[model samples]
Target: MSEPAEDPQELAALRNEIDEVEREVVRTVDLGPRAVVIAAAVFVLIVGLVLPWMGGANGLEVLLGQHEAVGKASWVPRLFATTSIGFGVLGSALAIITRRWALTWVCALGGWFASVDGVLAIWSRQSSAGPGASAPGIGLIIAEIATVVIASLWFRTAWSRS
Candidate 1:
């Protein structure tokens, strides 16, 4: 069978796309073995941000739209349900790549606090009255789990090094 002739313009575009993907992956590989796990955790956390945190809408929906942004207590879940991803990604990436002790503790402590917030977030959304509550969604749960793992990992790494 004769192969169809490839268009030069299309070929060039595809090549560029491939190169861009390669560069992105390379950036994620800076921490060696730790990089893989950290990247997965970060990916999970980010994805969770877009998923249903509770209520009828997903996290982005709540954050972007009519957020219940009142009361000091409201900030508990809201902060963890969002900033955990930011800290997880930024803290883990920097701590791992830089191998600095200060950053390690910062990530470990921050992650631990965030993990607790995640758990409480789930608790706050639960229905004591049964069947009536919206119940926690996968996104908040996944983010919570990832943050726990990230905290544990950073803590373990810090312990071993010390």
Candidate 2:
């Protein structure tokens, strides 16, 4: 004769148990030393936000469209600011804290995207400069460099797993 069907409650319990085990496995995975470097770079990026970016306006001012140059600047700088804060600082922090492989991949990809945005933002600032126009601020440059470093480190960490 054929075997009786399994109990529904038992099957649900088994599924929950399996999920817990999977989560434990993911939690135990190490991201190696690069995670520390990523954290430091994120910190640098945060510092960059408070420094002057355009027309003596800080990164936060630029992002918020409160800077005088914001009216003249293209969308590149604004976009860079969003991604840098969103992916570089927040996303990276979450991934580092959780140490989840999927989150790492997400941060890695987002970091690369933000890095490209950083380059374009710098280029836009330079290209748009005119007589008596203020040059790109030190903070912007520092933030861009930090973004690149963070992206590269995240890529290395994510790729190392595979």
Candidate 3:
């Protein structure tokens, strides 16, 4: 007589699927130019945080403490800082790593919107400021540029995937 079956067809299929998933986890694929651009975007966004975003207060200072906001610092800088890093950079990176197509698009769009907001916010702040107020600092400018690049890269990578 044949030996008893250890598992039913359904169970065997499930086991096979689990093994396949394990293998996929172990295997690596080339992320290539897309990854490089993504990394640079993230790096640029991060670096912008440390640089001055306004007359004296930097992105980091605006986010961490309100002490630097002694003058008429608007909330635009803080809002942009959080969204740019939290959603634009981090969300896109995570979606790329997991290879989630839908998520990639979401991140790309969100990042783009956030980047636009950052740019507009800076302009709004500058326009609203009293005469002689300093212009938007270097950090805001760099972060905005990086966020735009990040959005573009994400879309490019997603579309390029076959």
Candidate 4:
């Protein structure tokens, strides 16, 4: 077969087209990781907020009682519930905006702390326990521990992704 003559203009136009295609591919590739990270972060944040509102209040107080005295009478329960809901909402907001590993670390530590406290609460709720023990028994304790662990693990994994 005889070879056709190549035009300089044609060669330059083809090069430009290839360069644009390469640029688009590179841009898309770069966004892939970022998109994954953002989605994971959003998911973690949503769970963090939702967990407390949906039967998480009791578990949260159980967790808190381990570290400090919870009166569990009247306003005391309400106070702790509100606090948990507030923090959960705030933490979700933080996770959405920040990419730093430190924030993720904070979330992990907080989860662990809540879980440990929850165990202590179960201990306090025994039949022989004092009146101050308020509500929640061994069953709630087990649930809270599981929830905290799961949340912590999820946050940790999300943090590590980036």
Task: Score each candidate by Cα lDDT.
Answer: 0.72, 0.84, 0.75, 0.45
Model 4, residue 70: C-alpha shift (Å):
6.0
Who wins the lDDT comparison?
A: 2
TM-score for each of the candidates: 0.67, 0.81, 0.73, 0.40
Q: For residues 30-100, could you state the per-residue lDDT of candidate 3 as single tens digits? A: 45777777887788888987888776778777676554452445666677877887777678678758766
Off by over 4 Å in 3: 1-30, 70-73
**How do the residues 43-137 of candidate 2 rate in per-residue lDDT, one tens digit apiece?**
99999988988788888988898866677554788899999998899999899888887777788799889989988988888888565356678
Model 4 agreement with the true structure over 83-139: per-residue lDDT tens digits:
333333344346445543455555556555555544454444443255434445333
Ranked by TM-score, the better of candidates 1 and 3 is 3
Candidate 4 has a TM-score of 0.40
lDDT of 4 at 75: 39
Q: Per-residue lDDT tens digits of candidate 1, residues 6-125?
A: 999999999999999976654332345775787788788778878777665566654454444322334556777556855687888787776666677788899998988888878877
Ranking by lDDT: 2, 3, 1, 4
Error of 4 at 81 (Å): 6.0
Task: Output the better candidate (3/4) by lDDT.
Answer: 3
Question: Largest TM-score belongs to which candidate?
Answer: 2
